[model samples]
Target chain A: MNKNRLTERKILVTGGGAGIGQECVSKCLSEGATVAVLDRKLDKLEKNLEKDVSINSTVLVEVDISVGEQVCRGVKQAAQELGGLDGVVNSAGIDLVSEFDDMNWDDWSKVLDVNLTGAIHVCQQALPYLRLNRSSSIVNIASGAGLVPIQNRVAYCASKAGLIMASKSLAMDLASSDIRVNAVCPGAVDTDLFRQNIRDESDIEQVKSRYAMNRLGEVSEIADVVIFLLSDEASLITGSALAVDGGRVFH
Target chain B: MAGEFFIEFEQFVMKQRKVALVTGCANGIGRASALSLARSGMDLVLVDIEQEGLDVLRKNVIDLGSRSAVICGDCQDEHILDEVFEFAQRDFGAIDVLVNNLGRSAREHASSFLDSSPDTWSAVLDISLMTTLRVTHRAAPSMKRRGWGRIINMSSDTALIGDEGLADYAAAKSGLLGFTRVLARELGSYGITVNAICPGAIKTRAHDHLKPSILEKIKSTIPMNRVGEPEEVAGLVSFLSGDGASYITGQALAINGGRYML
Candidate 1:
């Protein structure tokens, strides 16, 4: 809690406006790293965190990650803002709850475009800056649904699963350059989105029962794991998928 | 390497110092893990087959401002393992973490597949997989009582790749991965997290036996074109033992510099 685990590091976090990505921004900044928050809604994040940290420590890059052109420019801007890049958190993703046969191509492809392709785009664009550093890490926010199938989430599952494999393969390809890549899967977390959606008493209980801990995880819990993976403490780790699920996958 | 992975971070605000027992604490990953845990403010119960390395590691732990107790004996010996547990109970009262670093089976003379007899296979299994089974079995009750525990088992990337001349080591490590998962499921309910660390081409003392040409070949095979350091593997262990890794379990975390991906 009192460690500067990522001291002097520069990090770029996608979807930093809310949820797990927002928490990662706060934690990384508190740990002595300057952060570039790439999001479509920077005003919301700025309002929430303006009081806790100096405005100088954070750089805002407004971009919708799904667009490759925006992502390319955003990655370059973020790298320039933070001086250089040491870490990246590909946390921008959307979950589509639709049956496979009922889903439209736009919806399905959008999910893949944002979650899987956008993440790869960010990594690909940031490669040169990342290579400039002595060591760097890329942590993609994959999900438990990625590794395990869930009903009514064909697109979500596929996108995350693809992101997981992409992360592993990227690690394999970039190991020679000392750029570490890994994916973190969060099972069920207590995000603002989940709080708004799972409102019924039965629905809440049903979700909790799925995990070994019989509860949902906090966004801060997932953020904690993400920062740990980004820091030097995990130097030996590469091409690994870390689960921050609170024992949800045990069954 | 394609393998089982595991890790745990501090889930609760620890008010008391945690105690960890590390087997094969004399050198390499074991020695580095003991030191890293010491640096994390955990008291250590260092175990190994020799007193010299344990003595030195104990001093290093003290230098890091932590307490340690060393026990010298082959952990594969049932009596030695018993003594280790009894000593911990008498002195430390509980072990919050266990590092299974010793991988030698009692009869492991020839590590190569064709040269290894049945005895060699069983010996490797007894030490790597069975010893961990016995120790975890012994440690789980205490962990359950406390509502938290961590177990780290050392596997090799060879277990995933089935590298030439290392079939017995691979089989034993593969078996350890399965045990890691089953226990991670069972003990997870009790707040115990189990995981395995698979290291590839580390420049440990054991590697000293490998010819320079062979070592160079191993390095070439790794995409990073280099061998890993003991401290690097220890860094993973240290992170797994922290509160941040609390949710990671039943995994085989490979630190091979991308030599193989599973």
Candidate 2:
């Protein structure tokens, strides 16, 4: 909890405008790293700093990651502004809530574009800077839904699953370059959006009962792991898909 | 060595400490885990068949500013294990954590299953799987009384991705995954978390004895293109025993340097 794990390192976190991504960015800053946030919206990350976080320590960049060209530009700008990059957390993703029969090509492709392709874009663009440092790590925010099927979300599942496998493949290709890549699979995080979206207390209980722990994980808990994977502590942990879920069933 | 490994509780009294009982702590992963746990501020009751290594480790733990007690004996003996837990209960009230580190990735031989005998299988199962069951059986009651405990089992990634000729070892270590899940379900409400770690080729004494050419071939098969260190696995052990891993249970976490994926 002391702020020295990532001292003087530079990190870029995609989808840092809200939820788990935002939390990773703030925690990275508090851990003595200069962090840059790339997302479509920057106001939330700018205004939503923790009491211990100083906005002066963060650089906010606005860009659509789904587009390769924009990601190329955004990553270059972030690395340039922060002087270099030592880590990247791909946390920007959207869930498409539709059955297989109800899904349209537009929705399916859009989900894949942002969740899977966008992650690839950021990794490709950040590669040059990532290799410049003594060590580098990439943590992709995947979902347990990717590992296990979740009904009513075919596109979301496929996209995240693709990201997890891609992360493993990338770890192999980049290990010689001294860059480590891994994925984090979270199950039903208690984010602000997740809390507001659940309709009733009974609904919450129903979800809780499904997990062995009978509760949802907090965003800070997820960030604690991401920070671990990014630090020197996890040097031997490349190509792992760590599940931060609260003892969800089957896994 | 001639008598009991236990020191009389009547001789010493101190404030309550977070005690972690790590079995097989004489060398390899077990020694590293005990030292790491002590570094994390946990008092230790170190168990192993050998006494010399445990004494060295106890001094290391004491130097780290944590209490360390040595219990040297074979864990397969239930009476010896019973005394370990009994002393832990009377001295520290109960062990807060247990690290089952008796499993060793066998380097005795790599003969095919056709050449393996059933007798060899039983010995492998006894040391890797049954020993952990005995220790857990003794440790669980006191943990349930306190409503919080952490149990970490050392499994191997070869258990998931079968090795060419390590069938018996694979079967025995893989059995740990099932045991972990069963205990997680039975102990969840009691606030105890049980999990297993499946590590790929770590540089233990076995690796040190291997020819450099053979070591290179093994490293080539892993994606990270290298073997892992004991201290690296120790870091993960430290995390799983902490409050941050409270919600995580029943998982066979692989610390392989990208050798295999589940």
Candidate 3:
């Protein structure tokens, strides 16, 4: 990967504290983008950074994208700090693990508010700067649950599905502005969320046996996708929901 | 072939010799596709129920001088799939290509859908249609991120032209074509191209099991008047996965030697 590809470009990624979001931040930095990391947990961001350092650097901001005021201020600060904005990656969102019938209004609202509405808020706040840039893009981190129905996470599925459609609509609206919009639907990635799920399962081996490919995916795996969607190499790509789920959804 | 198309594809494939995870590699078409892709220097994650066959494939892919991991398991099992992907990434790095080449049917169940049990139909769909969906869903994210990914799904000519006795198999493969088109539309923007390949009858144990009279009748329908080779179908799979077909998405390219066209 060329360090100059994203050189001098200002990129903002939400939920940058952990998992897929963290990987995106690191990848953007590696591609030479001046990245702004946004997350609710400042400590997690600091701790996550202790892992590996990219040749390209980033500025970390503690703000929740789900909150409108926080989102606006965060975008403004990131834009100011980085000089200007070239792209926004809406990778910050919550994952609730519960069935629809067993869930309450709060669960549904929480999932939608964070996953779907939070993405809208980020885009809404970032659009002004995004529209002004000659080259800009928005990459949303959706899930395979959004594309294919997952068994126990109804709210998560609905929110992700909405995000997919929302990304498409946004792509169409921003196509002329040269700001591409896209979403990545990751299938069971090997993150903390997956580890927790695995711990909860009685027979972990049996659970892993479901996919034809025979395993879960890595966070870096999903991050590599986000980088591509946000890069100039994908100049013609827009209004798409790509899946990164091993072979889980194939059948 | 268009000059620009070939150039673009060659550049794409060489620039990122993306790894591929292929299902149903025990024998038949899946094994052939895997070997062809390996020959092209793409690392492979080969899956199958027959451990012996998979071991042989691993050796062959290694002989091609490309990295390969053999996964012996049933495609219907989700856990096995997760491992296959993990192995692919752990050994070969990111997956840039995915080939869904698994096909199977019970001896008696191969007769007619109306006579087959619900379990038989479900099994057929799981292997043919669902397997395609699952594997592509898994491999696409990184491909999308890398801004270049290729998905070559294997559908059967029977699916397009239809087969009275093999209703379950036909329906499953037909459904796979539909899945391929929709996925092509959905994943086009993230730099991922999705397409399906429909192969005609080839010489394999699975085909050999079919009644001789029916097999002869099938060959007569072919304008080429001969059975197709697994390698021939594999060639198309390789082409589609390579850069030569970058602009070609939402397409179901047929490789049945004029036996069927759609």
Candidate 4:
């Protein structure tokens, strides 16, 4: 509420066109942190946020962070526009519905390319500027499927699982530096992408029923935790993969 | 009328109120641990040796509008523990949360390995390590029968990040970590969760001699640059107790304000 918890900090949020990414963008801006939104679609991003001048002032870049070359150029341009970088939240990701055997190489590659490789790109480009800041933190949004292998999500699960360990390794590697790295593992949330992924409505209900909360997670709940991990209050927490789910699998 | 008010109050207490039995509620982390659980809408069974402090806590828990059962006995005493379990059943019905928070912290004795006293080591292990087994050994069956329960042990960041003058405490707390993992694995099928909350140096009255400058330097070492409040620790316990943390089990979570990240 002081708004100074994240004040003057510049953050880059990828896949900012919709759902959880958009929520993270608004939440960060409300806390007085400058945000750079990276997404593929200008129309979708603009449509998601409208009539809110505070959110509109955020820097929007149309380049895909999953592409190595685009990530290099886009991160530099965004940091220049925001003046400096204090944090990078790798929230850009996609989930496919196919099972392991049915999944083709292209689907598998797309999942890994966007979720796993894209995260490294953001971190590599953001690290130099982050090292300059006093309390820089990187919050990578992984998934509950990463911790416990979810059925029929082989590619997505592998990508998120890789991201989680990568975050820990990065934290250990960056301990000497002021920069901190962590990840958030969220359960099923009522996000548009999540809803669209499930073909059967009953399957969605089944997923929700498996949780102790007996309901889907709110986007704001995960957003609040991300804000904490990114803020000074969570300064000592590096390399820890915190689950922001509504107590799914209880990690 | 007084009778009508009592009836209303009794019904209000019967619904949506959680009851917990916190072992090792006598001193150090255990005392603080019980208070944290009570702050989160829990009726408390505060077990400790310090009768005076227990009285103060009993009053405090009651003030929080929850029931209180003060049991002043060693956690390993089977007879005393039986009495405690009966008392909780009689006073508050089935226990919803069991915080295995009893432990001993010995700062002076046994610093030198060759000069270590057997009694000191036994006392530390009995209070810190074995007590978890004793309490959970009894509480888990009940928790399993209910199909919803939380078992939390007050562990130390020292177990993860080693320190001087704390070999015994560290060893005991580390054992508790193993217990947590094992219990979590076995109990997951039953829908019971087991975890540990490892805390760093809090500004409790125990550290009265700690110099301000040294404390400041210590704070500076922490990324948060401040000590955690008992309430902050309580917030995590509350989360763990609720349905929101059912998916998390067998984990050692450090609430040290960023002193040790792992």
Candidate 5:
């Protein structure tokens, strides 16, 4: 409820063009943080920010985070443009749903590359700059599939679970540097990516009924958690995997 | 910008004077949480076995300009839990936050699992786990009707890491985690978030009995190389009990100075 909680803080949000990433970008700007958005789709990023006056202060970088070289250069460029970096939200992720037996090596590797390695690239590049600031943080956007197995999502689940453990290991390694790392595991958010999975109106209703809340989560709900973990309010929280599901896995 | 969302959230919370009922408010994490919640603009209902401690905290809450109610009774007593909840609903109208901070690992009773008596197990479990079960059972219905509540249970890192001579304590605390997860699932639709906070080696009255050398040995094990303050744990409890943590449910957050990572 506090405005300007992240005042003067400069943060880079990956996948900032759409879905939960877009919500994080907007929320960060509203909380008074200078933002740099990295996404493969530069046009989508531009279109999302075009209506806001804060666009003047934002740094937009076209980057495919799955590529190591691009992430390294993009992070450096964003840092230079923003003067420095205080935190990062690795919200860029890709999920490919296929049965384990049917999935090819390329499909499995691609999901791991974008969802897990992409986050690693961002953290690796941002760590040096993040270490310079006090109370710096990194928030990785994992998913409920990471904590519990989801049918037909072997690659997605494996990558997210790995990402969650990676976050904990990084948190332990960076604790001495005052850099906190945490993960958010969201379940069934109503995003374009999520909508793409549903075939019909009845499918949507069926998915909604799986959760105890009898509804899907909004992107902003997950973004709210990202902002909180990045703020000074969560100084003591690190190596924690917070589930933002509407109680979908309880049953 | 999404500034309007936060403003609306602030207004929604400010529209009513929220009430928080905390157990084991005599000292340590409980006392710190009680004070923190009071400062966050919530009226307080403090429960503890020590009458003097409750009186002291009651005065502290009143000084913060928030209403205070004190119940001097053991949390393990079912009748005491019933009275506490009745008093809360009669006075506060609806319960908004519940902090189950009424558990401890007694040094005298802690021993090798094979040598420990049944009495020790019952005492430890009754105090740490059953008390949580008793109080949460009574407070949940009111919270469901209101459509918003925050329940924080205090667990220990011992349960996570499996320390020697703390088998019963670990079992009880571990049971709390299971309870927290199931309750979070059942209550998620009702707008009530259930979470457990696992703290490691915090400086509390419980630690006053330990020798300095033993404390130093404990500190060396932590990555931070220092024991945590009670306020650090309190800060987390306050954050979890606020509107910002609405999306976080069924989480077990550890504030243990990098001692354990899960």
Candidate 6:
């Protein structure tokens, strides 16, 4: 596919150090957007910049998105560095794998803070710059778990489900401002986070059987969807939770 | 410069030679959708009960430089639908797009739910829902073999809002939403996208028969303060059938100009 689909746009991607977030940053850059990456770690962001070999095209901000103050400052600084913002991809997220009985209050709160509230912080900080553009968009990287229940992931599922609703609410709130908000719900993608959840070959096979595609998704598959939602191609699309989960979730 | 770009794009699409089967293609949104797909360089298999309208649309499609096979018959007839698919296979080799635009509420029976007869319910369900199910069933296997297809079912805002006095119509159209969602899930692995378009108050021949005062009142109810053009809904159908909408499936998109939001 052509990479120049996002020409002349400026975008910020949170959780850009790894997994789906990292893929979004790379794809956005390739699609001809000057990008700002916010992540708790700077190593992957630096590597992405080095691979692109154009230092001026990207801004890397080291900050925890879960912290509201850090998110506000980092988003402002990145917007300043990129000159402005046309879109934001809230791909920053954390997952906790625990049954309801094993989960504590801190575990549940941590998941919600990073996945749901973190997205809210980024949207709040980026709204000013996003509104300046006539057709800006926000793509929240939610999960298939958000739409359907998965066993042993009570907190993770709750956080993502809340994020999906938050995405729709934001879409309605921002429609008058001309900023479209949508979510991409990916299922069992072969990312760092997904690999961490698999304990053996049997687990991989089991997960594969769950999808109609009979395999895990590539990070690029999910990233391509995020890029499409952020682009002008999806102009009429808002308040939509597009499932790029190989038919795992329907909505 | 724009003209030159359009010419170049048209040539590119013509080279692809996509094939589309559009039912109820004689007038209104169906005809507009057929023409829009032709503009996108798709050869069409047009079906409608009106022969004269089909001839006109066939001429127009030929003028657009796209081949068209016109069949004048009721789409709800299983034999007619079978013949449509057979003709598509014989001429176009495989159907790349299926636009299920054959549907209508029974105007004569537009009374309260309790006042409606079983015949009205059957007719509405047969015309609006069963036709979609039958056609999609026939076209799906060919689409699965080709590994790519776009199926767009025409539903209505009544399905979403459950408007009074149109209980039968609402039930039929609402059934389409559930059908589209399940079919999308079943066919996604085969690269076939199933989506429904829910339009409200589009200016069509059916509405021309309505009293002017009633039409005006309907327009007043719309937030856009005007009735929608058939071509407006056609634009969305064209988009849903195109490459840009590959990831979108099982969605019932509203094109009612803010009259309804989902």
Give the fraction of reference interface contacts each candidate recovers: 0.53, 0.49, 0.00, 0.14, 0.53, 0.11
Best candidate, TM-score:
2
Q: In model 5 chain A, which range of ten residues has the least summed lDDT?
A: A242-251
Give residue A176's error in model 2 in angstroms.
1.5
Give the TM-score of chain A, superposed on the true chain A, for all candidates in the order listed: 0.97, 0.95, 0.92, 0.95, 0.97, 0.97
* Candidate 6 second chain TM: 0.93
- Give candidate 1's root-mean-square deviation (CA, Å): 6.5
DockQ for all models: 0.47, 0.54, 0.01, 0.20, 0.44, 0.16
Candidate 4 yields a Cα-based lDDT of: 0.77
- Using alpha carbons, what is the TM-score of model 6? 0.82
Listed for every candidate in order, the interface RMSD values in angstroms are 2.5, 1.6, 14.9, 5.5, 2.7, 4.1
TM-score of 3: 0.54
Selected candidate, larger TM-score, 2 vs 6: 2
| Candidate chain B TM-scores, in order | 0.90, 0.92, 0.90, 0.88, 0.93, 0.93
Model 3 regions lying over 4 Å from their true place: A1-4, A48-56, A200-203, B1-262
What lDDT does candidate 5 reach at residue B38? 92
CA lDDT scores, all candidates in order: 0.84, 0.85, 0.76, 0.77, 0.87, 0.84
Worst 10 residues of 2 chain A by lDDT: A45-54
What lDDT would candidate 1 get against the real structure? 0.84
Model 3's lDDT to the true fold? 0.76
Judging by TM-score, tell me the better candidate of 1 and 4.
1
- Arrange candidates by lDDT, descending: 5, 2, 6, 1, 4, 3
lDDT of candidate 4 at residue A134, scale 0 to 100: 66
Model 6 residue runs over 4 Å out of place are: A3-5, A30-32, A45-55, B1-17, B25-42, B49-68, B107-109, B185-193, B197-262
Per-residue CA lDDT of model 6 for B134-227, tens digit only, reads 9888888988997898999999988988878899899999999999888887887888888888888888998888898988888665544567
- Per-residue lDDT of B1-262 in model 4, one digit per residue for the tens? 9999999998786756888888766555556556666766688888877788888878877777778888987778898889888888888877889888777676546475456777888888888898889888877887789777898888888898877667788899999888887787677667777888787776565555568897887777565566766555655666667554655666677776567764
Q: Write the per-residue lDDT of candidate 3 for residues B1-262, one digit (tens) a residue.
A: 6999999996676556668888887687788889888887788888899999988889888889887778889877899888988887777677788888886655565666567788888887777788777777778878877777888888877887886777888888888888887777667666676777777778877777778898889878764455777777776677667653444456565555445523
Q: Taking the tens digit of each residue's C-alpha lDDT, what string does model 2 give over B31-82?
A: 8989889988888998999889988998899899988767888999988887
Misplaced by over 4 Å in model 5 are A249-251, B1-15
The estimated TM-scores of all candidates read 0.93, 0.94, 0.54, 0.69, 0.91, 0.82
